[model samples]
Target: MRAFVAIVPPEPAHADLDAFVAPRRALDSPWRWTPAHLWHVTLAFMAEVPESGIDEMVEEVAVVADSCDPIPLRLKGAGMFPHAGDARVMWTDVRPTDPRGLGDLERLALRTRSACSRIGVPTAGGDYRPHLTLARSRRAVDATSWLDAMEAYSGPAWLAQEVTVFVSRANRSGRPHYEAEARLPLGRR
Candidate 1:
């Protein structure tokens, strides 16, 4: 299965970002805006996981969650993937509420990746910059203007209480949709 680990923000956070994106989505543009329901902050993208290995993966993730406490996070700022010069994906940063603190989400990503590594599946290799995807485009485009407008956006603060493994699939309309395969509460052994 094509799966990933993520934290789903609470309703207030969604409401905050929805207000920000709803207007921009109405305008005709090249970007294919993601529906509000699909918004998430990916911890690790495990592109391919064998069905037989799923149970073990979930167990490892549960262990990681027990060792990690619930984190206070806020969705803020904006940026593009593969640099803004020629960008294909746009997103809002997921960050700790405190200006200075241990990097909670980054550590979570590393632990998630480590768990998957133990399962013999390597996650997408890269330095983790936690962010919630907002939109995508087929071709690269200059997004400075969009970045400037979104740079100041800071959504509602929420507690990251649980982590989920999501199975990705394309719906009838060809839009990507995610289904939760496993959910584990943070700080629960």
Candidate 2:
């Protein structure tokens, strides 16, 4: 199965994001707005995972989770991927609420990626800049207006206490659908 590790924000946080995005959707924008259910902060994206490795992955990820403290984060600001002028993806920032939480979330991401690679599951290589993807455009275009509108947006804060390994499958519409395979609680292992 296609698998990835991610932080799925809790229900309350989802509600807050819904409230923030409702007004923006009403404007009939050009981008295909992502539904709230699809929101997540990916830690590692492994293209495929054979069944033999699931046990190793869970155990390894659990160890990483044990050492990292729970990170409190909020969704704020906006930016475009591959540059704003020819933007294909737009996302809302995932930021630590205070100085103490800084680097912790990124550490969690890096450790998890390393854990996966140690098990021979080659993960995507990139700098892990935390963000919840908001929407996608079919073609590259100037998304300056959308970026400007999202600049003032900030949602309610929430404690991210768990890391989940998700099985990603393609739906009929060619969009990715996620199902949590394991919920690895952070800390207190």
Candidate 3:
């Protein structure tokens, strides 16, 4: 199955982002916007894991979760990945700061990749920039209007208590439908 590890944004935060994107959804742009419930910060893309490897993947993910603490993350601002010059993904920034010290979400991503590495799957790649992906455009957008819209988009502060490993399946709509394969609680340690 196609899979990925991600930090699920708390519900209140999701609602906030939902309100932000609702109006923009009608802009007639060449981008596909993600459903509000699907908004999340991807920790690592685990790629395709056969059914036989799934059980072990779940076990490893639990270990990583137990070693982590719940993180307080606030969604803020907006930016396009790869810049507006050649934008593909449009996302909102997140500030993962709290619990006195340590970047819990960032470390969790590293540990997730590290755990998969031991099994020779090599999950670690890309600089970890925490953001909630809003849309993916086939063509670059005039982000100026979008950026201006974001200025008034406000969502509640959220506490992420768990990370989820999901199995994704592409459908006729060309959108990926996701199912939770495993959920690992944070601050278990």
The lDDT values for all models are 0.86, 0.87, 0.79
Off by over 4 Å in 1: 99-102, 169-177
The local distance difference test score of model 3 is 0.79
* TM-score for all models, in order of appearance: 0.92, 0.92, 0.88
Clashes of each: 0, 0, 0
- Write the residue-wise lDDT of candidate 1 on 1-189 in tens digits: 788889998899999999998888888877899888888888888888887877888888889988888889999999998778788999999888775423877888899999899879779868888888999999999888888988889988789999988877778999877789898899875
Over 4 Å off, model 3: 97-102, 169-176
lDDT digits (tens) for residues 1-189 of candidate 3: 677889888777787788778888988877799888788888888766777887888888899888887887788888887886567888888775566423767788888888977775566468878778999987766676666666565567777788898887777898887888888898788
RMSD of each: 2.1, 2.1, 2.5
Q: For residues 1-189, could you state the per-residue lDDT of candidate 2 as single tens digits? A: 678899998898889888888898888766888989989999999888887887888888989998888999988889998768899998989988988675999899999999989989888868888888988989998988888988788888889999998887678998877788789889865
- How are the candidates ranked when ordered by lDDT, highest leading? 2, 1, 3
Model 1 lDDT on a 0 to 1 scale: 0.86
